[model samples]
Target: MSLRTVAVLLADQAAVFEFGVLHEVFGIDRTAQGVPAFDLRVCAEHPERPVNLLNGLSLNVPHGLEGLLGADLVAVPATELREFSPALLTALRDAHDAGAIVLSVCSGAFLLGAAGLLDGRECSAHWMNTVDLAAAYPLARVNGDVLFVDEGDIITSAGTAAGIDACLHLVRRELGATVATTIARRMVVPPQRDGGQRQFVDMPIPECTGDSLRDVLQWMSEHLETEQSVASLARRASMSERTFARRFVAEAGTTPAKWLVLQRVGRARELLEGSNLGIDQVASRSGFGSAALLRHHFTRTVGVPPSDYRRSFSRALSA
Candidate 1:
């Protein structure tokens, strides 16, 4: 993959972060850092137009869709969902047909869907919209678990940050590991990422039929460090184990074990983000027993390893 030129296809209401990530990855003069510079241009369906962005921002795109059609890579940033014009959609299809790699960030996959590029292909989007995306394109396989899906020429990523991963992945695929690593280092991000969108999903409070099990749930949360099991929890709830299991599923919208693991992971995350505690101490306090077990659960649930997660989200970073 001899990637050089990158055309960012834009529309009104484009998300700032998604659009900026594309620019940061490919538009910057990174040759100083030994990474090949990309001939990147911002393109719109209408040339030399001011497209209103989300959050009261606006961008003057300098090129027309022809810039996208002739590029080695055509990138679609997150844009408001709507029916794309026949000309714009045709340009997208034409770019792919002419052997250009197509990439989308966050909701940008919706535009690819509208262009009929996702038919029978694996597509990933922000978890909140995966269902709508699948419903919209009946033939597309919408997978919400992964951070991104690389269907050879067409790559789709989930949410804003995942766009970085997808872009780095494309860079590594075409240029090599050294170039991707240099870019990641310059951006102060990891060259390779792990896990999936599921880890970033917020665990919503279960809307229960009643508050009968509220006390028990509260107790479980308060004592996350303590060893617990269905038998012990059932005793605390004053219900038989069988009945407790049934009620937990009804009220929590998930099994008790899954809920417990997620809760413990949340506690571990708090410690990792705000405390100077060791990984072993964090694991013990979060009821994971040992460091290995903690890593297994945390990595599976949160995408990155605990230490990496700490570095990315530590209070120091935020400050």
Candidate 2:
């Protein structure tokens, strides 16, 4: 069954970005992209009450808890970390019991945790909160590295932009890849990024020093179609191979080979979304060397093959 009705619960100190993420995904009209609009409603504890936001702004929510009664999906955006009232918790549980999908963005997982929906489920949240989430709910396995977790009816996402990925993933699963891709194109974001992709927070790269390899990085991006090796890169940066390797990790937050693969995948995604190039041509241009290699890495990284990606996202005019 497809999701049609969505209810986003509001609380005191709600985050504008996370709330906006939900609205951007399910609350807008996208008939131009061939995607159907959802019956979207925003709910708060008090109807017609002005709810305070984290940024000092306030929203006058028109719907109360009654708005959640028949929603096909119930979403909770990030809010201040605190326990919800018994009534709100019961509503969340009742919605899940009624077969509605339950979703949380960022620290909103804490609300689900409070509602006892996360017990014994593999879930996640923003990395900054994963430690506390795990400590509070030891039965729930909280993986901080992933962008989101989809445990059947319950889905949770990491901080900020990760909510977009999780929301689009649900759209793809329920609607179809065509709809998901079209919506993604309209939003001007990559159609999909696998949940397991790193949050890009493990290593912090400091601002460039005088000897930074900014020029070398730009050169590599431009020459991705050609071969790249540690020896060649070290020569271009005028450093020893060992020093280059060390500095590359210090500056880029990843090893050279891993960084190169990520860049290649990004380029391939652009070609798949915006160009009419065949699979082999895309592989050649993205520095994958062969279609088989591209398929292996792209599938591992994107959770889909190149042709399937193109079918989902290739523009109609280009196709």
Candidate 3:
């Protein structure tokens, strides 16, 4: 396959950090591994003009909106100014219409929405802007709790670090997980995060006199293969089942049943990726009881069957 050209649109008062993320991922040459590296260029609506960044530093971009004509992908980083220039929006729309994949990092979704690229598309941005984005673009389905949303040609990510995840996702989709892992290793970031941004839930914590629930949680981890029940957990914590259920939800951010399922699925994933255990053995060890049960929840939660995930991760490790 031919090398892909990536054009990044730089706006006045653009976020410097978000732009740096694109450079860090796509600008670097990783040709030693025989993978095609992107040809990256910074384009502006006004060529040869100095634009001020969020950090008060000005950068001169020589390429005009015409640079986006030949790009295979166009990235618009988050801007300090909530609004985007009319020319830049038109350029982005032209790129999208010309068969280029359009991507946004954080508040860049606002620009895409202005260009009418986000209509009827599922997207994500920083959680703080979720309501406003949704209110502004009623046609766009805005999900703030995910790291990123991959809608084939148009993609959007939530917050700063998630931009890395979105970029790696593109790499994985285009070049496979092996190449993506290589880039992640060079960049010193995880190839994939465990859960979405929802896992970083913000909640008020009430001080507890004693952490009896913590003891039960530790015991549950140690004895995952053993049959677990709400009554058993309540007894272990020396509380009524009703009170234990409420306290467990408060402490864990999720219900006990949901938490147990997540833990079991996580264990199954570890065993599948790290060990050569068969499906049945993995199922039993992870407290799923049977392979069918494992397959049911694994497909529902992880979005892939156990065998396929193992094959992909295993190839990534060997690569």
Query: Top model by TM-score, which number?
Result: 1
Model 1 agreement with the true structure over 77-175: per-residue lDDT tens digits = 998856788998999999999999999998899999999999999989888888989988989999987889999999999998899999999999899
Considering summed lDDT, which 10 consecutive residues are worst modelled in model 2? 202-211
Shift in Å, residue 286, candidate 2: 20
* C-alpha positional error of residue 91 in candidate 3 after TM-score superposition, expressed in Å: 0.8
Tell me the lDDT of model 2 at 170. Answer: 94
TM-score of each: 0.89, 0.66, 0.65
Select the stronger candidate by lDDT from 2 and 3: 2
- Please write out the lDDT profile of model 3 over residues 1-319, one tens digit for every residue: 2228999998888888899899888898988965577899899887767878887798998688999997988998987666777888889998888888888998989889989999999999988888999999999999977879989899899888888889888878888888889888988888875324332333232323347677888787778798999998999899999999999888877777787888888888788878888899999999999999999988777666888778756543554
**In angstroms, how far off is 9's CA in candidate 3?**
0.7
Ordering by TM-score: 1, 2, 3
Error of 1 at 24 (Å): 1.2
Global lDDT scores for all candidate models: 0.88, 0.87, 0.83
Clashes per model (N, Cα, C within 3 A): 0, 0, 0
In lDDT terms, how accurate is model 2? 0.87
Pairwise lDDT winner, candidates 1 and 3: 1
For 143-185, candidate 2 gives per-residue lDDT tens digits of 9988899997999999999999999999999999999999888
